[model samples]
Target chain A: MASFRSSLPVYATTLDVVWHYAFRTICGAILVFLVAPILVIIPLSFNAESFFSFTSGMVSLKPEAYSLKWYRDIFTNGMGAPEAAFGWSWLVDSWRHGQWMLALRNSVVVGVASTLVATALGTLASVGLSRPEMPFRGLIMGLLISPMIVPIIITATGLFFFFSSVGLAQTYLGLILAHALLGTPFVVITVTATLTSFDRSLMRAAANLGASPLRAFFSVQAPLILPGVISGALFAFVTSFDEVVVVLFLAEPDQRTIPRQMWSGLREQVSPTILAVATILVLISLAMLGSLEMLRRRVERLKTETPI
Target chain B: MTAVELGTEGLERRLARAERRGKLRAFLLVAPLLAFVLLSFAMPILTLVRQAAYNTLVSANLPETTALIADWKVDAPVPEPLCEALVREMHAAKEVDPAIPSRIATFVNRERAGSLSRVKQVANADIKAPYCAGLAALHDDWAQPDIWRALKIVAPSFSPRFFLQALDFRLQADGSIRSQDSNEALHLMLFRRTLLVAAGVTLACALLGFPVAYLLAHVSLRVSNMLLIIVLLPFWTSLLVRTTAWIALLQQNGVVNDTLVALHIIGEKGRLEMMYNMFATLVVMTHVLLPFMILPLFSVMKGINPNFTRAALSLGATPSTAFWKVYFPQTIPGLGAGCLLVFILAVGYYITPALVGGQSGQLISNIIAFHMQKTLNWPLAAAIGTILLAGVLLLYWLYSRLVGIDKMKLG
Candidate 1:
C-alpha cells in the first residue's frame, strides 16, 4: 500500500506541498470569511445607488465616481428626508442624512459615563481584593463576575421589570447605571488580571522609605498597572457602546442607543443608511479595540522586561 | 499603616495583624456589592419566586372578597359575609376602572380552560338571596368543578406551576399535569433545540478554528502577528453591524446572490431562502463565535512546546501518530475552555438569531423575551430564566470539575 503511492498522478513532493498549503489556505479563507462581512459594509455604504447593490463605479474600484449620498442621507436628509410618523422624526432624519453625528454623540456620552463609573468601582474592588489576606475573595470575585456570566437577556428582562417597578425604566440615569453595572465585570476582570502582574515589593519598598500608601500607590504601582486600568476602561467603553439586548430592554425613545436604533431599523425596515452607520461604528470600534490591544501588549512587554 | 511603624511587635505578629486588617478592608470593599446584590439581585429573585405562585389576579382585583374569603374553605357556599365582600370589591374594582370585569374575566377564564360549561355554571350561580344585591342577590348555585380546580391549582402559596407552564405543561381538567398544547410536546423541546443549535455552532467554531489556531501557533511570529490582527479585527465591530452586514451580503438581491448568479452557481431561484434560514443563523453565529474559540486555542497552542511531536517522532512514531499522540493532548484544556465559553455564549444569543433566524431559529431566550415584553407573563419568563440560570450554573459546575477553571483562560 505504501509503495503504491508512486502509481498516483502526484509525486510525494507534490502531495507534501499540496497538503501543507491546503490547510494554510483554508485557514486564511476561514479568517477572511469571519471578517469579510464587516469589511463589505464599508464599500456598500458608499454606493451611489438607492439600493444595497454595488454600482459599476464601486465594483470597478473607482472612488471618484462613487457617491457620498448615503453619508449625506445619513445627515441633512440629502435624499429628501422621509416623513416620519409618531414623533420618530429623529430616527427618520438620521436615516436620511447618512449622518450619525448625534448617535455618535449619544453613544460617546453613554459609553464614557458607563466606563468611568464601572472602572472606578471595579478598580476599588480589585485593589481591596488584591491583598492575599483578603477574606472571601473567591466569593466576591464570583459575585462580581456573575453579571458577566448570567445571560444578558435574563439580566435585561429582570432589570426591565425591576427598573419599571422603581419608575426608572426608561430614564437616562437608569440606563447609564444599568450599562455601568453590565460594564463593571469587564473592568473588574481586566484590572484584577493586571493586579496579578504588579510587583508588591516595589510598593512595599516605597512605603518603607516613608512614602504614604497612597503616595506609593500613585508614584510606583499606578504607573505599572495604568495600562491595564486604561485597557479595562476601554473595554468598559466597548461593552457599553456595543451592547444591544440590555439597551433594547432599558432605553427609551429619548435615550435610544445606536445598537437599539439599528435593531429597530433592521427589523422594521431595510435601508442603506444602517449600513453607513454600521461601517462608521466598525471604524470607531476598530480604533478603540486596536488601542486597547496595543496597551495590553505594552503591559505584557512591561511584565516580561522587568527583572525579579 | 505600615507594619514596621507598629512598636514592640515582631514581624510575623505584625504581619498577622496586617492580615486581619486586610480582611477587614476586603469586607468593607465588598460591602457595597453585598448590599447591591441583596437589594437588586436577591430581591428580584425573591420577587420572581413570589410571582411564580399564588393566584393573586382575582384577589388583587377584588380586595374585599379576598380579605373576607381569607379563611373561606373549599366546600363553603357563598356565605353572607363573602357575598357582601364580593359586592363591595366588585363595585370598588368597577369604580377604580370600568374595565375590571374584562380583566377579571380574563383571569377567571384563564383558570377555566376547555370547560366553558363548568365555567358558565359558576358564573350563572347566585347565593345572595335576600341578604345582598346584584351578583349575590340572584340566588343560584355558582360553584363549579372547573373553577374549584383553577382555584386549587393556584391555592398554593408557592406553586411550581409557572415552572411547569414555562416548560409548556399545565394542569389539565382532570387535575393531572400535562402538555400545555394538545400536541403533547413540551416547550423543553425549544430549550433542547436551542442547546443543540448552540452545540452545533460551537462544534463548527472548533472545527474551523483549530486549523487556523494550529497554523498561527506554528507559523513565524511576523506571520502570526499579522494573522492575529486579522483574527482580532472582528472584535472591533458591533455584533448588530456584523449581523446586518450578513443580511446585506446574503439577502435575495444582495451581494452574495448577485455574485453567485454572476458566477453561474445558481439562477435567481435559490436566493430568497438563504437569508432567513437556519443556515444563515448558523453561519453568522459561527462567524461571531469563531474568534472566541480561535484566540483561546491559539494562546494555548503558542504556549505548548513544539518539541513534543519531534520527541515522539524521534522515538519512531509516524508523523501523524506523533502529532495525534503527542501534540493534541496538550491543547485539551484550551479546547475545553473554548468549547465551554463559546457554547454557553451561543446558547444565550438572542439578537442575531432573532434577526436572521426569524420564526424557525428563535431560541428559548427569544421566547422568554416574548413572554416578558409582549405577553407580560413575568412569572413564566422568570421561571424560564431561572431554569436557564440553573442550567448555566450546572454547566459551569460541571466544567469547573472536569477542567479546573483556574488553569483555563478565555479570550
Candidate 2:
C-alpha cells in the first residue's frame, strides 16, 4: 500500500506526501512518548554507576559501563555488611535485612489473599447477577463496583477512620480487606462478561441428567469460564500488588508493600535500587499483559468453537 | 369444578412456588458479597461523610460549659455562670481523663487559633471566688467574646464547622457564616486547582491520544494489536514505577535535562527545574492516562464504518471535510467517555502529584491526606474528602448516563 501510494506520480503530490508523512510522524512520536519512560528505566537500571542518567562510558557503550550491582542491591541492600565476602551468612543476612525482599513478601501475600477473596465473592455474585431471575442487577453491580470508580483517596481516608474505630487499622487484615474491596470490581467485570456469553442450557441439561447444580458448575460451567476467572484473578492480584494509596493510610511500617516501599524511597531518597525494582515491575506487567492477551484469545476461541 | 381445572390450579401454584425458590436461591448467592461490600466499602464512605459534620471532642469534654454558654449573647461579657461551668467541667474532665482538656484545646484551636494555650492556662489557674473575674485575670483571652463565640459554635456534639471550614467559610463572633480571611482560604483554591489540573490533563490526553488512536484504528489488525500492547504495557505497569520513570526523566539532573544540556538547548548552569512542578504533574499524568483515552477512542473509531467518510469524499467532499463532518461527530461518545474518565482519575490523583507535585503541584487529595495522617484532623479531612468525592461522583454519574459504565473496559 505504501509503495503504491508513493509510486503513483500524480497521486503522490508533494503536499499529500508531506501531509501523510507528518501524520505518521506525529503518531510515531506519540507512541514513542507513551512507551519511552518505561523503556528508558530498563537500561538505566543496568548502569554501573548509581546515577539516574547514562554516564559518558555508557553513552559510548563501553562494556565495563554496565553492571548488575543495582539488581544485586535488590537482595543485599539492607544487609549489615553487604561488602562482606560471599558466604551463606551474607545470604542469610541479606534475606533477613533486605527491605525489598520483605516488601516482596508482603506484596505477594496481600495480592494472593485479596485476589482469593475478590475472586470468590465476585465470581459468586456475578453468577447470580448473570441470571435472568436476579433482581436489581444493575444497581447491585454498580454498588459493588463503586470502589473502582470512587477516588481511592476518599476510600483510603474513609477506611482509615472506620478501621481505626473497629480496631482493624494498621493490621494485615485491614490492608487485605481494603485491597479485596478494590480488586472485586475487576473480578466482577471479567466474570460477568464471561457469563454473558455462557449457555444456560448446558446447566439445564446437566440437571436433566441428574447432576446437582454444584456438580454441573464444576464439570460443565467452571471449565468453560476458568479462563475468565484466572484472568480476573490475575487482574485482582495486580490491583492488590500495585496498590499504594490504601497501604499508605492503612499499612503499618512492617506491612509495607513494594509500591509503598518505592514511594518512600522515591520521596526520602532517590536510589538506583528503585530503578531495579521498577525494571522488575515492568517485566512483571509485561508478563501479565501477555497472559491477559492470551486469555482473551482463548476466551474468544472458546466462544467461537462452542456450538451454542 | 372439574378434575382438570383443579389439577391445572394446583400446577400453577407449584410453579409459582418454584419461581420463588429460584429467586431466593439467586438472592442467596449474591447475599454474601453484597453484605461484604456494604460493610467494607459503602459503610466506610457513609461514615466519612458523617464525620464531616460531626464534632464531639469539645462538647463531649466540656458538656457543662457548652450548656452554660449555649444561650449567652455574643455582645455580652463572659458570664460568671459560664466561667464557673467551664472550671467545674475542666476539673471534672481532668479527674476522669487527663487527656480531655488537651483534646478540648485542640478542638477549640481549630476554630480560633492560639486560644488552646489560653484554655490550658485557665484550666491550670487557681481561681478564688468571682469565677468570671478570676478567669479573666488568669488569661485576657478568657475575657474576649470571640473565644466564647468559637466555643459556642463547636459546643454542639454535631456541628457543620468542619464542612464550613472546608469551603473556606467560618462562623463570625456574632454567629453568622462568612468567607474566611484571604490568607486562610486554602481548600477552595485547592479545589479549583484540582479541577483546573484535571481539565488540563484531560485536554492534553485527548490531544495526544486522538491521533494515535486514529492511527491504530486505521492500521491492520496485527500492527494495531502490537501498538495496543505498547499502550497496554504502561497501563499494566505499576503506577509508582511510571511516576518514578518520570522523575528520572524530568529531574534537573535527569535524562531530559542532560540531553537538553548536551544539545545546548540550555546550558549546564541553566538546567530547568522541571521535576517538582505542575508541568511535571501534567506531563506525567497525561502519559499515565493517555492509554485510557486511546483505548476508548480506538474502540469507538474501530466500530465506525469507514464508508461514511469514503462515501462523503467520493461524492464531493474533501478528506478533511469528510473527516470533520462524519468521523469526528461519530467519535464524540468515545471522546466524552475518555475525557471524563481521564478527568475523574486526574482529579483524584494523589500518588503521582505527591511524589513529583512539589509545593505548587499538590492537589486537594494531598491536603485531605495531610489532615488525615499528619495533623490528626479527621473531620477536616473528611470534609475535603466529601467535596472531592461529590465532584467525582457527579462526573461518574454523567459518564454513566452518556456512556454506560458497563462499556468501560480495562486491559
Candidate 3:
C-alpha cells in the first residue's frame, strides 16, 4: 500500500526515515485504540460467566467457556416464564413481556417516526436553501443547527418545564417531537450538501420540457439525491435511537428506549445483558456505517462522472 | 397578454415578478421546519430562561412582607411594621398550609444557612404586632437585617440570585455581591473544571488525531478509505456503548488491569483503580471524540496541494521548516474547527462523565443534571444551564465562523 514512504525523497536522511516510521507507529496505535474497546465487547458478550473480564477458561480457548445466555436473556429476562416449553406461546411471551424487547420497540417507534418527520422537514428546507433566491440563508441555517450545538441538558431542562406545562411531557408524541428537532440538523446538512452539488441544468432541462417545478424535482432530481436523503435519514434515525438525555428527562418508565434502558440497568447493576444489547447496537451501527459508506462512494462517483 | 406590452420596462417588470415568486416558493418550502423548530426547540429554551430568572415561591407566599420591605433599607433597624407583616404572613401561611413557612425557610436556607429554624420559629410563635421587640427576643435572627435582606432578595418575582448562586457569588444583605467561600463554590468550581477538561481534551485529541489524519490524507486512496472506517466506526457507535466499553476496559478487575497483572507490570493486589475517576473520564471522552478531530483534519489535509509543501522543500527549507511553515499553517482552519467542535461537545457531555466520572470527575453538566434530577432544584439547574448555554453559543459562533453551518458533515 502507498504510504508516506512512497512519497519520500530518494535522498531522504536517516532522520526522515525515523520520523516517517515513528508517525506510522503512532497512527497505527491510535487506530487500535479507537477500535479495540468496541471489538472487545463482542467476545465479552459471549462469556459464560457474568464477570466483565476475560476468564481464564475463555482466555485458554476452552469451547465450553463461551455461551449465548446473555443474548438469550435479551429476549427472556422479563418474560413471565422462561421455563415454558419452547413453543409459540413462549415466543409470544418473550416478545410481549421482555424488558429489552419493549425498549427495542420503543426505540424503533420513536426512531422511525422522528426520522420520517426530520427527513421530510429537512429535505424541504434544504431544497429551499439551495435556491439562489432564498432569503436569510445564513440566519435560517444557524437557527436550524442551533438545536445541535446547544447543550442537550439545557434543552432537556427547557423541554421538561415547557412540556409539562402544555401537557407534552412523558408522552410518545413529546419524545418524537423532541427527537425530530434534534435530528433535523443532520438531515439538513446531508441533504443540503447533496443539493448544492446537484446539477441545476438537469432541472432546467426538465422545466424547459414544460414540467412543473414539483414534476421536475420528481423526474430529474430525486433519483440523484435519493442516496443523500437515505444517508440523512439514517443519521436521524441513529441519533434518535441512541439519544439518552432527552429520553432521561422526558420518558416515563413505559417509554424507555434502548439507551435509557441501558442507563437504568447500568446504574442498577453491571449485567451482561447490557453488554449483549451494546453488541447488537454496535452491529446495527456497523450496518448503518456500511450503507453510508456505499452512498458516499456513489455520490462521489456521480460528482466525478458529471462534467461541469 | 403581452401583445400590447413589449418594451424593456415590461420585460424588467415580468422578471421582477418571477423573482418574487421564486423567493416565496423557496420560503414556503422552509416554513414548516422553521415553524416546528421555533415552537418545539426555541420556545422550550425561552421557558428555561424564564425558569432561571424567576422565583415565584417567595413573591407568592410572602407578598405582604415582600411589599412592606420593598423600601426598607437592609442596614436599617428591622422596622416594626415590616416585622409585624412578616409574622402575620407567616402565621397566616401556617394556617393555610403548615408547610409553607418551613418551605419558605428551606428555600431561603439555600441563600443563608441556619434559616430553616429561624423562619420556622417565627411562624410557630404567637408574637403580636409591635412584634419587632418580641421577634428579636424570640430569636436574634429576627432582629438582624440579614434574614430580612434574604427575604428582600428573594421577594421579587424576577431575581439574579440563582444566577449569582450558579456563578458562586451571592447578593449580600446590603445588595453588594460577594464571591462564595471555597466550601460553597461548587458550581464555580465545576465550571472551571469543565473548561479545563475541555481544553485538555482538545489538546489531547489534536495530538493524537493529527498524525492519523495526516496518514489518511497522505496514503493512497484505497488505503485511506480502508483506514477511514476505524474513525467512522467509533463515530457511528452508540455513545453509551463506547462508555460501557471503556468501563469494561478500565475497571479494577477488567481487561487492562488483568493484562497488566498477568504481564507482571502490576501485582495481583495492585490492580489499578482506573474506573470512576478523572482518568477514565479523560480516556473515554478522548476515545469517543477523536473521530470528530480526525474527520475534519483529514478532509482539510486532503484538499491541500501537495506541491505547496514540495515547493517549500525545493526552496532549500529544512524538512521540519517545510512541514511547519508550509504544511502546518494550511491545516490551521481544520485544526481550529476540530478543536472548537470537540471542546464545545466535551463541555456539554453528560454521559461519559456521569458513568465513569466518580466524584472528582464530575463536570458542570453532571452537576446540572444532579440538581435537576436528585436535588429537584430546577431553577438552579436552569441557571447553570444558562451559563453553559452562553459559553457553548459563543463557541458555536466561532465554529460557524471557521466553517459555514451548512458545511457540517457526517461520515
Q: Pick the candidate with the highest lDDT.
A: 3
DockQ score for model 3: 0.82
Q: How would you encode candidate 1's per-residue C-alpha lDDT over B1-411 as one tens digit per residue?
A: 676666546766988888888789777866665565555555655565556554466667666665555465555654666656655565566667767654555544555654334323333344344434444224232333345445445434446778888787886434478767657444688899889999999999999999999989987888898888788878667889999899988888889888888788988776557777788889899989899899888988999998888789789997689878899999997898889988888878888888998777788888888877887667778888888877887776666566544333324
Off by over 4 Å in 1: A1-14, A60-65, A77-102, B1-15, B33-46, B54-85, B92-104, B113-144, B155-157, B172-175, B183-186, B400-411
Evaluate candidate 3 and give its CAPRI docking class based on DockQ. high
Better of 1 and 3 by TM-score: 3
TM-score of candidate 2 versus the correct structure, residues matched by position: 0.96
Candidate 2 lDDT tens digits, A46-124: 9999899988889999989999999998998777889898899888888788998889989999999999999999999
DockQ of 1: 0.49
Q: Under CAPRI classification, how is model 2 graded? A: medium
Per-residue lDDT for B224 in model 2?
91
Clashes of each: 13, 0, 0
Two-way lDDT contest, 2 vs 3, winner = 3
Q: Please list the residue runs of candidate 2 whose C-alpha ends up more than 4 Å from where it truly belongs after superposition.
A: A1-14
User: To one decimal place, how large is model 2's interface RMSD in Å?
Assistant: 1.1
Model 2 per-residue lDDT tens digits across residues B112-186: 889888877666777867998888888878777877787787788777778888999986656689998999899
Of the pair 2 and 3, which is ahead by TM-score? 2
